[model samples]
Target: MEAGLTERSDEKGEEEYVLLDLDAVMEHVSIRPDTPYVLTGLDTLNPMLIIDGKVKLIGEYEETIGTCLVFSENEAPVLHKETGPSDANLFSGRCIVDPNQVPSKEVKPVARLQKVLKFRLLLDGVDDAQQDHPSTEGNASNQSTATQN
Candidate 1:
């Protein structure tokens, strides 16, 4: 899933994936200070792996601590981090970017189904219905359904 650039590259005859720049995505989402945006697609290989887009409070990390774009490999490792008490985070997600990749070259996450849905919703300033009680087209399937139906 692409999440860091708005366009794709044509390399090795590989289909370019849709990726939005991180800064643009954050600005579009209006991420506030110290807010951690939890994007779901990084945990699964499926196109629609991301269940929703959310912002949460997390312990400070040395990294920038925003939405990180994890690349995928043939086999990606689960992301397990312990931020605080009672919080055991485990992400067995796979993305287009290689997980083991040290990013010798700069790349971004492509727009997988979940990332696209989440980004569109975020651009419109809405969250998934399951998390947000106030519903305003929070359904990811809304667009896909509308297009199909």
Candidate 2:
């Protein structure tokens, strides 16, 4: 892949992956304060492997669902002096982000099929015979089958 500053890098070879400046990436992804974004496709030997930054979450790409991108990775090791409940505390309030990961240079991700999460929606009383749903013309395949009771 060409360098990050190239104007047509996204259109060139390895089109699915394009190097972009931090500002350009931020423009495409609107991030709110303190919200953690699970970035997928980082395991594809991208140059970002050795970049200096704090990583809240990272994963390998699994598949796309609804408008969301899915990913999977093993649980990260707990950071030193974790803020969560003590082992003595059985009931937990909420999980905190206090995990440690080896430096990217030291860790080379292996390409393999992860024991990924499979999800499904269970809706009762859904029948196709009485179906009449409103759907937009464009991007019909992306839309879900609307159910009526």
Candidate 3:
């Protein structure tokens, strides 16, 4: 608690002092919690690896012309194959929850979002062209679109 050093006692009764910039510690992020945010540093090609967990979230499904769209965490739609007749749970029905079954206490996330990330768009050399610019016949930039065909 003194200055910038945070002190904490370990299970072994040993004192550990860690240095941290407290101002950069963010409890609230700019993004929405209900919305699903994709953040993986690894391969996204096997999208099922990244997408499979979404089917467990609370959402509804819609049947389109060819495919059925199932929604994810934030009501984000995910395309799925239509459930045909012979399927066991095809017409089982919607899931219903009783009001008394809902938990009373709200669970706050235990994960600490220590680092605050900020990004700026730095576009270099974006100049506007003059209106009604004149072009010369011999100008290299004035190439004809006519092809050999």
Model 1 regions lying over 4 Å from their true place: 1-20, 45-149
> What ranges in model 2 sit over 4 Å off?
1-11, 17-52, 65-149
Against the true structure, candidate 1 has what lDDT? 0.32
Each candidate's TM vs. the true structure?
0.18, 0.17, 0.16
What is the C-alpha lDDT profile of model 1 across 31-88, one tens digit per residue? 4444433333322221121223453211111222233333433333444344445434
- Runs in model 3 lying further than 4 Å from the true structure: 1-96, 99-110, 126-149
The order by descending TM-score is 1, 2, 3
**Top candidate (TM-score):** 1
Tens-place lDDT digits, model 2, residues 1-149: 12321323344543232122233334344444444322223434221211222321122233332232222234354434435758886446654444455522222222222222221221344332221223112211221111111
lDDT of 3 by residue, 59-143 (tens): 1122223321111122223333434546676434444334545334322221122222222221244331221233211211211
Local distance difference test, each candidate? 0.32, 0.29, 0.24
User: Which of the numbered candidates is closest to the native, going by highest lDDT?
Assistant: 1
